[model samples]
Target: MAPGQKLYPRATVRKVVKAHSGCNVSKNVDVMIFLDYMLFMQDLMKEATIEAKQGGERGVTARSINKVTKKTLSKFKG
Candidate 1:
């Protein structure tokens, strides 16, 4: 799985449940809840990553503008 990929395919759920079969948690209810929780978390993480990326881009633009303004002010003063 590549970094930042949030796709939680059914195959993954099946694998997890199969791996945990010895724990008596292979029931439909338990599996459904687990899958739902996993999907919810994945969505939250995806949103957070996207928001952070957008904020970072805005920060870069703000810094660039600040730098240009400072340079212009310095030139005017000199």
Candidate 2:
């Protein structure tokens, strides 16, 4: 595992459950699912942050504009 990559221990798992307002029967299981989802969201946030910074340096146009234009052009090809 890397710096922030580690499996949830039993205690952290419980906390995640509580954070999500879990019920008794499937709380732990739900927590595990939530942990995985949170981890995925964290990775996406990190990537977006980096991309935004790089885009900021580029200037003149935003990524959404570029992305939409690319999609529009690709659609015309079909």
Off by over 4 Å in 1: 1-27, 57-78
How many steric clashes between backbone atoms does each model show? 0, 0
Backbone-clash count (model 2): 0
- Quantify all predictions' global Cα lDDT against the true fold: 0.55, 0.56
Model 2 vs. true fold: TM: 0.38
Q: lDDT per residue, candidate 2, 5-45, as tens digits? A: 87758666666666776655454675656776676555544
Q: TM-scores of the models, in the given order?
A: 0.37, 0.38
Report the error of model 1 at residue 32, Å.
0.2
Error of 2 at 55 (Å): 0.5
lDDT per residue, candidate 1, 1-78, as tens digits? Answer: 899998767666666776766454443645576776676555544554555566675333444444345444444341
Mark the 10 consecutive residues where model 2 has the least summed lDDT. 69-78
